[model samples]
Structure formats: C-alpha cells, structure tokens
Target: MFTGLIDKLKGKRTAAVKTPEIMGLRLGASFELDPLAIRLILDELTIESCSPTQIIRAAGLVELDGTWVYRFYTDDDAWLQVVAEGGQTDEHVVDVKLFHFYDTLDVAGQQAWDRLLQREIGAASYSLRERTYGRVWTSAGDYHNPVHMAEKTYDGDGEHSLTDQFTMLFERPLSDQRTESLFLSAEEKQEQAGYLSRSLVISTGITLTPSQLTIHG
Candidate 1:
C-alpha cells in the first residue's frame, strides 16, 4: 500500500512541472534581495534533516506559466511598467518620450515645441532613429491613454505624437568636433556614449541597482 501511494505522488509531481510558451514578455519593478531561511518542503527532506532555504528578490523576475520575465533596472529607479521589454539599450538612440522636459514643459513651451515640430521655428530637440531591438524605452511611438475614473474610452485633447520623437542630443556640438562622430576612430568617442548614458541616469536620480539575472527552465 505504501509503494502504491508513493507511485501516485510521483505522478502528481511530474504533472505539476510544465514548459511555458511565451508570446511576449513584460517586466515589473525591481525589489532588493530578501534572503530568508525557512523550512524545507522538498520530498527528499524531512524536518529533522532539512536544509535552510533563502529567498532572494533581486531583478524582479516573475514566472507566469513557467515562463520567466525579468525587470530592467538602472541606478535611480526600476523601469515602471506592467509589461515591458526593458529600457533603452543605446543612449545615442533615445525615445523622445523619455525626456522629462516634455511632461514638465509649460503651456508656452509646449506650444513652442509644437511650432518647432511644424518647422515654424528652429530649435534642437531630443531625437533618434527607431531601433528594432532594445528595451521598451527605445520605442515611444505609441501614446498610452490615461484611465479616466469618470468615464470609459475618454481620450482627452490631443494624443502624444511620435512623429518628432527621434533627434540627436548633441547635434551641433558633435558636428563641430570630429571627436563626436560615430565613425570617428577615437576610442574616446566610443566611450562618450556610455558616459552620457550613465550621466543621464545619474541626473535623473535613477539609483543604479546591481545586476541580477535568474534563469529557470
């Protein structure tokens, strides 16, 4: 009777483990690692011979239906999104929406931006060409409508446009100096992008989190 019961339990355990099919993936906010020691619950271990278990919560990775999803983190804050591929990978190619300037700009400034976009005025704006591969922050082409508590399907005013989303940050400065050219042989120019990327993270108060990677198959 004990042998028969053990066979049934093994069958159940095998059925519980399944491979996942991922159509797409989204990463959530990151949390610090919390290592906790708890009781052993594996079938091989009894309380008398159990080993401690530690819970590490780093690089917010969640498994849905056995599929693993990981969060993107920088120095300041975890990329805030319910579903995301990650944040920008290339600093040179940035999405306009990532700029804090747009959200905080005054009405007059917004109008000025509109005019500049319309070619009515001349001004420098953050722009970069669209890239196929990278984090979610790389693509700001779609405008997310805010949820309205009062009503459903209410899209207020004008939708955020991505037509003018890409531009060089230091266009003029870079052009004036060969040191800034992407094709330039200078190693310094190659490193310049990295420096700027980190500086942007620092200026934005994104406390860089330590890298965390967890894989479960």
Candidate 2:
C-alpha cells in the first residue's frame, strides 16, 4: 500500500519536481531529504485528495515518526513538527509541535513541558504563555512583547484520529493582520493591510488561495 502511493505519485509527471526522488521509495530507502523538503512532501501527501486512512494504515506512520520528529523551520524562522507512535491503528497517536521564532522556552518552561509529558496531558487541552525579558520593549512601539503568541503542544500518546491530527497540523486561521505581515515591502504591506482590515478570520491553507477566502479592500 505504501509502495502504491509512491508508485502513483511517481507515475504522475510533474515536470520540475522529479517525483522519483521524493524519497527514493522505489528502493525502500528511508527519508533522506532535509526538513523543508520533507515538510513539502507531508504537505502534499496530507492533502484532501490523499486518503489519511491509507497513510495511517501503512508504514507511513513509522516513516513520519522516525524522520519528522526533528524541528522544521519556515523562511521566517517559525518551525513545526509531528511525531507518530504505536504499532496498531487504534493505538496510534501523533504529537504536533509548532514554535514561533520569538518565543523561547525558559528553564521553568522547559521543566513545565517535561511535567506536562510526565502527566500525559490530554489532546483537548494545551498551555500557552508569553515570553518576556523583564520590561524590555521592541522598536515597533507596540507593547514590549506585543500580543504575539507561539503555539507548541505536548500531548500524551493514546487513541487518536490521524485525520483530525492532519487538519490541526496543516490548516491555519487566516486574518488581515497575518495577510498584511506577508507583504515584504512597505507599499505592498499598506496595500494589503486595508483589504485585510475589513476581513474576518477564516480557516484556510497557510499558502493562501482564492477559493477559500475573499478579502475586501
């Protein structure tokens, strides 16, 4: 079944991507790609068209666990990760980790994470906190730390839904502020800001597509 997904993808001719090298699955070699490339592969595999059941039922979960546990970063320094465990389908559980670049876990925060794991906090709940350096302020003139928050969770291994886990890891809320931040130039940022300011948050792919969103200027 795992080989079938690879064969299907390999059979499709994507001009620039060179599907055979996606993981060298043809040879039964383990993942040898870097974090970004792996993230891109996961992003493609977990799409709506791909059956999550097939993925979970196959050896894919083992690959995901063995290879993807390390942190993966975005261009802006934000990072995310996923780890799967258990041998049986019903026993399978996945842990997702996301970290915004600005938020660094302190010694106490690290201990808290360790305790959270020790206690096996359930999936329905999470802990979030703002990091600060005393009364330090940023050059942006907003609150010193601003209202930005990083999201990283450590949940206990147990019975879980892989589909639900996929959604949580891939889909993200879209808003004007986030759209505005995407712009690199001042003019572009100002242009998108007006449009995003009038829009409401919606669940959409982080890449931004017109199909799932309609922002007004």
Best by TM-score: 2
lDDT agreement of model 2 with the native: 0.25
**CA lDDT of each candidate?**
0.21, 0.25
Estimate, for each residue in 41-78, the C-alpha lDDT of model 1 and write its tens digit. 12211112211211212223333342233332223322
The number of clashing residue pairs in model 2 is: 0
Q: What TM-score would each prediction reach against the true structure?
A: 0.19, 0.21
Clashes of each: 10, 0
Candidate 2 has its poorest 10 consecutive residues by lDDT at 180-189
Q: What TM-score would candidate 2 get against the native?
A: 0.21
> In model 2, what is the error at residue 133, expressed in angstroms?
26
Checking candidate 2 for backbone clashes, the offending pairs are none
lDDT, residue 103, candidate 2: 31
* Per-residue C-alpha lDDT of model 2 across residues 36-69, encoded as one tens digit per residue: 3224343332222211111111111213333323
lDDT of 2 at 201: 15
**C-alpha positional error of residue 82 in candidate 2 after TM-score superposition, expressed in Å:** 10
